[model samples]
Target chain A: MRFYGYFRSSSAYRCRIAFNLKGLAPEVVTVNLRDKAHRDDAFLAMNPQGLVPVLDTGTARLTQSLAIIEWLDETQAGARLLPDDATARAEVRAFAQIIACEVHPLQNLRVLNYIKAHHGQDQDGAGAWCRHWIAEGLAACEAIAAAQDHRGAFAFGDRPGLADICLVPQMFSADRFGLATDAYPRLRAIRAACEALPAFAEAHPARQPDAQ
Target chain B: MRFYGYFRSSSAYRCRIAFNLKGLAPEVVTVNLRDKAHRDDAFLAMNPQGLVPVLDTGTARLTQSLAIIEWLDETQAGARLLPDDATARAEVRAFAQIIACEVHPLQNLRVLNYIKAHHGQDQDGAGAWCRHWIAEGLAACEAIAAAQDHRGAFAFGDRPGLADICLVPQMFSADRFGLATDAYPRLRAIRAACEALPAFAEAHPARQPDAQ
Candidate 1:
């Protein structure tokens, strides 16, 4: 198996945490997004979306971090990434989607670049954009986490499952944009619990081979 | 079961298709997005994200269309929303996320309103923004679908599944924005195939109780 990703992509970071949790280490290939390697024809051929964290599973290639994580949970032997109960699983996935769909895309590198180019946003403006979406989405996540009937040390249950997998990365991003997460006590606590684990710690952007 | 949604919400439309496919008719509650009904304390208490397509399953209220659809597939008795094979499931999910995560969020009412309020984009500007993202994302979806070795009439297989559930609504959004989808023949074909089915037809925004 081979994993293609950049060091700082939250999407790739997600798959990295999933890999560590599952106790599988695929050979890593760093696609330098800073250099626009992801836009190259070679990378586009591999993934027409020109995105990171493409998992080549020998037999098939997987795109999208959540889908790859779900596939890992289905076929992998180690820790389960999703809960078994249907409703619980839905809760975890919904939490993940709040970050993945609602928050992350609004502040994606491409989106920021587009806004900067066409929407007249400079670096500070883009950062503000990121912070706005991050803060709003995290507030929702905190609310949902606080409302959970059986909240654990993690987002969903006692173990660090899909929700934590998504939360930790978005928290990292929150910090990146200088958005203080202190307002979200539940998310802060969840991030603390997740960061203490080796799986999440090792997958941090600062720990990657391609980190500057 | 109770389903809270807005007629024009693409996310809500995805769940409506899933419900129709699963043959489960949950009680429908239309939250008027134009009137900001989702921001009411009552709705916010149910969904902190203030988004539509919340499914109350008596035991638990589910948010996030993909999560709700997956839950329906896992617990309901009907046509399978996800394929059996893990790799196949990932492909279908990746296709769905291309629309849900990458495309839909950029054109969301909240995001567009944010851009208008802060980014100096007028109505035409927002429409352009939506078209750019919709075209870019549909191009990726088309490329991926065209690359599939076993292309079926739908996005994945012979029967409509998760990918088609997402694609149909996104296609609707594209048309609403006056974006021509002719460039994405694969997606156009998939949309045509999906729209021919009663399951997809019944879920159209025009057919909803509160469409106007």
Candidate 2:
């Protein structure tokens, strides 16, 4: 298997965490987003969306970080990324989706570039745009986390799973934009727990081989 | 089960299609987005994100259309919203995520309102913003559909599943924005096939009871 990713992409960061969690060492290939390598013809042919974090398993080529992570969870027998209970799984998925579908998409590079190019937002303006969505999303995540029955070291229980994989990268993005996360104490504590794990520590954007 | 949704919301449309496919009639509770009902205190308490398509099953209150659909697929046995095979399920999920995580979020009302309120965009400007993202996304979906080894009546195979559920709502949205989708012949054909089904047909935004 080969994994295509950029160092700082939140989506790629997700795949990295999942790979490490599953204890699978697929060959790593970096697609430099900064140099527009992701938009190259070869990359686009592999993924029509021209997005990073395309995992090729020889049998199948997959895109979308969440989809890839779920695929890993299903195919790999070890570590259960999703819980056995149906309702608990829904809670975890909903928590992850809050970050994936709501927050991260709005602050990604393409959207930010669109705002800058068409909406007349400068660098500072784009930062503000990113911070606004991140803050809105994290506050909601905090509320949800606070409401959870089991508030251990991780997002769900004592074990770190899919929600933790998504939350960690999002917090990284939040820190990048200089957003204040003091309000989300539970989320910050979960981030701290996740960061302490070797699986998550190795997957950090700064720890990646292609980090600037 | 009770569903909270707006008729034209793409997220809610996905849930409506899933419910119809599963042959379950959950009582519909309309949260009118046009009137800002989704942002009401009660709705936010139920779903912190303040987004629609929240399904309360008396056991679990699920948010996120994809997560809700997956839960329905898991709990309801008769109809298979996702395939049995792992790789096939990943393919379907990746296809759906292209629209759900990418296209639909960009053109939703809140984002459009943000552009208008902050960027000085009027209706026309917002429409252009919607069209731009829709066109770019659909072109990729068309490429994906065309590249599929088995080009059946739907997005994945002969049966209309998660990807098809996502595609139809997106096509409706594309038409709403006056974007030309002629370039996406494969996607349009799949949309035609999906629209012909009673499940997809009844789930159309115009066909909903809450539709204005």
Candidate 3:
């Protein structure tokens, strides 16, 4: 397996964490999003959407961080990331999508470009937009996490699974944007627990080969 | 099973159509997003994200349309929306996420509100912003749909599976934005095929119980 990613991409970071957690390390093939490499012919040949964090299974490439994660959970065997029960899967998935779909997309490079070009937001303005969305999403996620009675130092249960994989990266981005996360105590605690793990630590953007 | 949805929500519409195809006809409840009803106490009890298209499976409430649809696909045993093979399932999910994760989130009402307040886009400017993203997304989707040889007239093959369920609603929103999708013949054709079906037609946003 191979991975296409950029260090600063939270989505890619999520994938890296998943790959590491599943104890399956794929060859890291960097797609330089900053230089518009994703839109270049070679990358488009791999993913038409030109998004980062595509997992290349050698036979097929998977797009979308959540989809890649799901594919991993389904195909892999050891320490399953998602629970087997249908309802449990939905619960974990909802938390993941709250981050992956609702929060991350608003703060992506393309949306940032739109803000810069169409909205005339400076870097700080862009960061503010990013923070605002993160705050809203994190608040909702906090509600869900706090509601979990069975959790043992993690977002869902004792194990750091799908939701934890997604949560940690977003908080990383949030800290980068200088967002105040004191409101989400559960998120803070769970993130601290996840950060202590070797898998998430190794997958940090600053640790990636493409880090500038 | 019961589904709470707003008529114009492409996300909700996707789940509704899936339920229809599966012959589940989950008791349909309505959440009017325009009135800020999704964020109301009653609705948030079901989904903390306060987003529409929450599918209550009797055991728990399912948020995220893709997650809900997938759960239904797995547990309901009806139309078999996903392919049996792993690679095939990954492909279908990748296509679905392009719209669900990448496209839909950008055009959502909350983002438009932010654009209006922060970017100084009036309703018209916000709508323009919406269309621009739609065009960019559909262009990628068109490339994707045309690139594959699915078995059916749908986005993948002949079967109206998950990708098509996601695609058709996205196309509906595209037209609502006055996007000149004549350039996207494959998308339009696939959408026409899906829309022509009673399941898709009945799932149209305007046809929903809370359409007014």
Candidates' C-alpha lDDT: 0.94, 0.92, 0.88
lDDT of 1 by residue, B105-135 (tens): 9999999999999999999999999999999
Q: Which segments of candidate 2 are over 4 A away from where they belong?
A: none
Best model number under DockQ: 1
- Order of the predicted models by DockQ, top scorer first: 1, 2, 3
Better of 1 and 2 by lDDT: 1
Give the per-residue lDDT digits (tens) of candidate 2, residues B22-63. 999999999999899988999999999899989999977999
Q: Tell me the number of clashing residue pairs for each predicted model.
A: 0, 0, 7
CAPRI grade, predicted model 1: high
Residues A23-104, candidate 3: write the lDDT tens digits. Answer: 9988988888889989898888888788887888978888888888889988986668998888888889889989988999
Ranking by lDDT: 1, 2, 3
**TM-score of model 3 relative to the true fold?**
0.97
Docking class of 3: high
Positional deviation of residue A87's Cα in model 1 after best superposition, in angstroms: 0.6
Model 2 residue B34 lDDT score: 89
Query: DockQ: which is higher, 1 or 3?
Result: 1
- RMSD of every candidate to native, in Å, equals 0.9, 0.9, 1.2
